[model samples]
Target chain A: MAVDEGLKIELGKQGVFVTTIEELYNWGRRSSIWPMQFGLACCAIEMIATTMARYDLARFGAEVFRPSPRQADLMIISGTVTKKMAPQVVRLYNQMAEPRYVIAMGACAISGGPFKQGYNVLKGIDRYIPVDVHIPGCPPRPEALLQAFMTLQKKIDGQPLTGPDRPRFLDAEAQGEFPVPVQGEHDLEPTSNPGVWTVPVVIR
Target chain B: MASSPYFSLAVLFVAALGFGLTPLGLAWLWGRVFSPAKPNAVKNAIYECGLESRGDAWMQFRSAYYLYAIIFLIFDVEAVFLLPFAVAFTGLGAAACVAMLVFVLMLIEGLAWAWAKGVLTWA
Candidate 1:
């Protein structure tokens, strides 16, 4: 019933489709990427606008946003990740089922934006979890996020599961978990630093 | 014993339930088979808006709400009793009228007592 305009004449004899196993697999995975229904700060407003009637993120088949991290495969770090919230963010990232992705949406999520020198702000979410796409803006417009989605889809299409040098998420269950940060005197630390964790016992 | 009409109803109910549950079951199966689920300590921890939860949630609640709930119950029960009286009003005799009058008077008395006690005022 439906056909591509350019390919109409080319497939006049036989409209039968053909594709390799990997292509089919990649297409299925990239199409229905369910992002987490999570937000941190102001940039979240723009993220929400992208899903509304005007932008209609559902057109690309990625409208389902799961509240639970276990259900979501895409994480959009929409705003600045504060030091106090680092542990919980890492924890959330670890819970996401593979093949999972992280999109550092907006400059705040990418590198703390204008709050780069703030005492409470984490430099970037990448300090803990690996990022897939980085969209740079103090608070990127809805169009920018849509562009990020396109870029991420393209990235997903390139990954193959059969090769030796395959991406980490190629084997759905092979993703390494990021260490949850621990509270330190000045800021949260990923490692069990003796300077932070070990209490100096008072001796007589 | 099973009959044709009841059997038809059972079949319809079963079809409805199946329609509702099939999609949910398939989704769960697909997620279980295709999605990887490996949880650790931090990943499994309760979410509290991206921060660790503070002190115990339970604390002593204010007693003023108790009076409000009790007042609501009195009026709610009064409406339940009044329903039968209103339904049988045209068929009732003088004796029933007297009894209904007494019942309304008692309710009015209770309301007056609560009003006198300043229970109606917001503290």
Candidate 2:
């Protein structure tokens, strides 16, 4: 159960911390969101800049970009998700430990950007893996990436530890592995992950 | 038992173990209650780096690399001994000189044997 905000504030003023298990759990999870070190294209440079001194993503406790999916808590899709690279990306996402989050950090990653018409581009990484945040830009500035990160943290903080609305990692029955697409004779065997995404039917 | 000196040592040992184990036990319990493990083929795969791993890690290396091992030992051991011998050369007695000569000759003999075996010739 959530503690009353006013009561919590009063307790804090009196030097006593009042927090529920959910609050403490969410606090810990939101604080240390280590992004995977994998990068695809130009937006990766902006992602790198965000971690550097000027933008200082370290302030949010997300400076540690783990090279392995096993250690990473977040995956920043920082560029165009080409069809050629989509399989590997989905495989990496599948391999990541539970409570994983994805940030589609550019126009390219979110919706293929200028390469949308190109046959080589995957259109969006969310086609294969669920994206937690979508930052709209050809290549989003470091500040935009930081904003998306804070938005993700807020999303994490609001997630209930228990109940039907609890995040996928907390849900035992939720699908764990997103299928990795294979290169077919023409294109990827499967265009999108049906579990996470479905082709939107435009109503005329 | 309270008067025994070993009792305090036993207490400290138990405290030390508790200090290390308490958090571990708590974490395990927390996982069991809250985070249900979600293991699948992709997540449990042997290779972690995106692409599926191709070959066996148990593949054999070329046996011809042993020649380089012998060559390395000859130079490495000679350098190690020769540096100290050279540094203390003027202060050494004739017996020490003879001993050093024998050591150098032994290494030289190994090199000569390697040369006779054509081990130095790069294929």
Candidate 3:
């Protein structure tokens, strides 16, 4: 059962903490989001800066950047997702443990940015894997990365632990593996994952 | 049994074990109930560095490398021990000197064995 905010505040005033299982679960999950340590391009420099002293991301409890996808809770796709690199990126995302989140940092990752017309660049990473937050900019400042991280934390906090609206990881029926795209004769075979992304219809 | 000297130690030991095991038990129970296992080929793969791992991790090495290992012990390990022994030589007792001598002799004997076996000869 959900506790009334007013009642919870009153309990806190009386030195007693009031919480539900969902709140406690979400709080713990959102607090310790360890991002995978791989970086794509120039935007990766900003990602590194976000974890460094001045913009210290540890304040949000996401400082630990795990080298292995197995230990990571978040994947910060910081930079351009070239067609050549896209397969490896999707594979890394697929290897990540359940309850993982992705932050498509910078315009390059969200869209191909300046390289949109280029033959090699992948339009966006979200075409293959789902993204939780998108931070726009050629290479967004450390502040932008920090903001995206907070947005992800908010998203995590609001997720229901049970019932129909619960997050994908909690749902046993949810798709387990995001298919790792392969390098075909021309471009990435299958283009995009049908499960996560659909062809954006053009207006006449 | 309550009045026995070891009774308190038993209680403390139980408490220490409970301290460690309680959280582990709770985590296992929580995982079973909330997070269902969703293992797949990609997620269960041995290598985590994105690239597909090729071939078996089990590979054979040459048995002749044992001679190099012995030689390394004689040269590298001997220098490490000898430096400390030399530095403290002035304050060492006759017994300590004898111990150092025995250690040096054992390393020399290994070198001698390797030399006699033609390990020092470059093919």
Q: Tell me, by DockQ, which candidate is best.
A: 2
Worst window of 10 by summed lDDT in candidate 2 chain B: B64-73
Q: TM-score order of candidates, best first?
A: 2, 3, 1
How many residue pairs clash in each candidate at the backbone level? 0, 0, 0
Point out where model 2 deviates above 4 Å: A202-204, B66-123
Clashing pairs in 1: none
Name the candidate, 1 or 2, with the larger DockQ value.
2
> lDDT of model 3 at residue A154?
93
Error of 1 at B97 (Å): 11
Residue B6 displacement in candidate 1 (angstroms): 19
The DockQ scores of all candidates, in the order shown, are 0.26, 0.70, 0.61
Q: What stretches of model 3 exceed 4 Å from their correct place?
A: B60-123
Model 2 per-residue lDDT tens digits across residues A1-204 = 667899989999999998888988889989999999999999999999999999999999999999999999999998988999999999999999989999998999988999999999998998899999999998899999999989999999999988999999989999888999999998997988899899999999
- Computed on alpha carbons, the lDDT of every model, listed in order, comes to 0.81, 0.93, 0.93
Error of 1 at A22 (Å): 1.9
Score chain B of each candidate by TM-score: 0.48, 0.80, 0.56
Error of 3 at A76 (Å): 0.5
- Give the alpha carbon lDDT tens digit for every residue of A1-204 in model 1: 335655755665587565656677789989999999999999999999999999999988889999888789899999998887778787888777677899999888877889999999987787778889999998999999999999999999988656565667544555465677888987787533232134348999
- The CAPRI-style docking tier of model 1 reads acceptable
